[model samples]
Target: MSRLTVNKTYKLYIGGKFPRTESGRYYELKGKKGNLLANVSHGSRKDFRNAVVAARKSFRGWWEANAYLRGQILYRIAEILEGRAEQFEDELRAQGSTPAAARKEVLKAIDLFVHYAGWSDKFQALFSSVNPVASPHFNFSVPEPTGVVAAVAPERSGLLGLSSVIAPIIVGGNSGVVLASQSRPLCSVTLAEVINSSDLPGGVVNILTGMRDELLPHLSSHMDVNALLLCSDDPAEQKLVQGEAVENVKRVRLHPDAPLDESPYHILDFQEIKTTWHPVGV
Candidate 1:
């Protein structure tokens, strides 16, 4: 009898090619059974910038998309994700999740997708408000897409946390540069495939795996980035990212370092600012 061998390395998702990391830095990933899954490429600043350019190019069309259309696309993504729940669970298990926990995470992830999917149409109503400031002309406020955002997925609940942060921003019509969870990034890369297959235009959400300390600073301070979401629980680093966010006044979210459970209204936390302009005169 002959023994069979299989290749199991992952690729860097850039320019639509799953090429190996440009910097050639690779890291070992342990699986649910404590077995080595494969080596994941560690993205660098150059790679991050490349992803940013892709996002910026894709932003105009995505942002200009009608709210209902965007909602439909996002909802479609949720539908696809639900249909492919097993695939995500398999990836999660490869990242070291038990079957029960993987199922729970997949369900939450679907809910997270649907949650943000709904917001694609509703966030505008929730965040956009009419102001009666007794002004000379019809004055009101509206929330606009904040252009490109940079995100860091929570280190722990790697898959679900990444989805929670990324979905809201993109559904709201903003493009993003996301740093995948360093320890367990397989799910993030797989998510890129999900978005690619969905109605979402290219670059709506770009995922990169790399050292947080190395890549986050550039993302935070990058003048092109309009906002950021720090999903990690490290107060020191969180504070630093927030501080850098101030330079660009990037919107920031500091998620709690809690158990891998659903947080209430988590999607709302990152939705777009929608302000409606209307006349105060009756």
Candidate 2:
């Protein structure tokens, strides 16, 4: 393949338009052989704050949209993935994955979408249970979106890990800000293109590629972030992030490494439990 002509411009994806990073910072993605794959922008705290605000503002509509509609949108993303499989695979390979493994990762990502799409309607029933309580009232519990979430995808397995982290949250009706994998950032930025082309909402899932250690502290402490999912391989660091989340009492999920076939329960980790009671008699 020929070299990617280094471009002179880039745009931040905020409020659906690709504008330059507010801080006017740009960084390069260096391949294992020290070649440049692409230039990704480093998001400032202000940019991160702006994205969070956008996500929070968009949360109500996304969480309230009919589950079927969300499912349809997710299904459309699957179609888009299929159409862009080669591009995604090329990105995977560009990020140090073997060609064969890149192909597998791309397929795995699509499979994840299909899996979540199937769950869009079914998970509600499975998670919601009619409680047999010791009260004279009809009682039951259901899961609801936890509002805006902040996520750090795994450092390796770029595309696959990204899809895994993203599918579950949005499928459950939550909006999120994702700190893309630092080692393999190109694919995550490219995913923004895929999302813009798919049926996903404007701010449902925002992707930012930057220095993880620098950005994660901000995400962990942000009160607007209702929940946080850290998918790093460093157990100690994961523990520290979980600790920071306790200040705001924000829900925290720590995974050193979740398998490719991780169960639906892990996806439910970022959700909130909501219960309702109604009288059956006057």
Candidate 3:
């Protein structure tokens, strides 16, 4: 007699809880050798809408959190990732990454989180400006979270790319709805578990695994989403996203390729600069 193994049922991570797609449909994920990797939820427009609602609802709490506290929460996520290093590496391998590459990517993802963690409390200083005005008034500009962001995670590298895109957005106090790597999505859900356990507030980061073609329109056209982050090189697809975004005049940031390094500029991509004027003397 052979022992039975219980396979994992992967679901969409929304508002800090895992739920099957409202469509109740799933697509089989396969490894390099065509072996069944897992069954991933086939997210639909409803799921994306739900995620946007969650992100919007949680925006104020995350935005009001102190910078230092946000930094600490980001660091805590990195710490959790470190503890789950082996599991991530194994999942990467299952997704067809060579053992060496898998290990390297896992480490890179962890370091990326740490890099953004350090930036959480520091980016404002670098980007904000106090103007030298001639009048009896003080003028200054500060960065504020852009609110709900909809992102399509990089399709090439599952864990590393997803981490790179997500870290900057949330660290800057903006909530996000991310469509994970369609083909290799295991690590995205796994990271959601790490986020759920961290001090970060729920609904701050929602992860959905589904086909890009099916979800892009909803993400780009949503009226409530303040911005859009696309990680693709397809001109047609880019054009489509941009065209749809015009409906709400949503800010669109396109990253044709994964960023070379975890730069603070990525955080600014989803930030809105607000200027204020104050009387210098009473």
Local distance difference test, each candidate: 0.76, 0.81, 0.93
Cand. 1 Cα-lDDT: 0.76
Cα-based TM-score, every candidate: 0.88, 0.93, 0.98
Extract clashing residue pairs from model 3.
Answer: none
Per-residue alpha-carbon lDDT of candidate 3 for residues 154-209, written as tens digits (9 for 90 to 100): 89888999999899999999999999999889999999999999978889999999
Top-lDDT structure, candidate number:
3
Off by over 4 Å in 3: none
What is candidate 1's CA lDDT for residue 248? 69
In the range 1-282, model 2's lDDT, one tens digit per residue, is: 899875634345665556667888878888879998777788787888988998998899998999888888888787888898998888788778899999998888888888888788778888888999788989989998899998888887688888888888888999989888777776776677777777677988888877888888889989999999888778677877888898899998876654245366855786777899988897
Clash count for each candidate, listed in order shown: 9, 1, 0
**Cα misplacement distance, residue 133 of candidate 1 (Å):** 2.9
Error of 2 at 1 (Å): 17
**Candidate 2 — which residues are off by over 4 angstroms?**
1-12, 258-262
Error (Å) of candidate 1 at residue 39 is 1.0
Provide the lowest-lDDT 10-residue window in model 3: 253-262
Clashing pairs in 1: 32-96, 127-274, 128-274, 128-275, 129-275, 141-275, 142-275, 143-273, 143-275
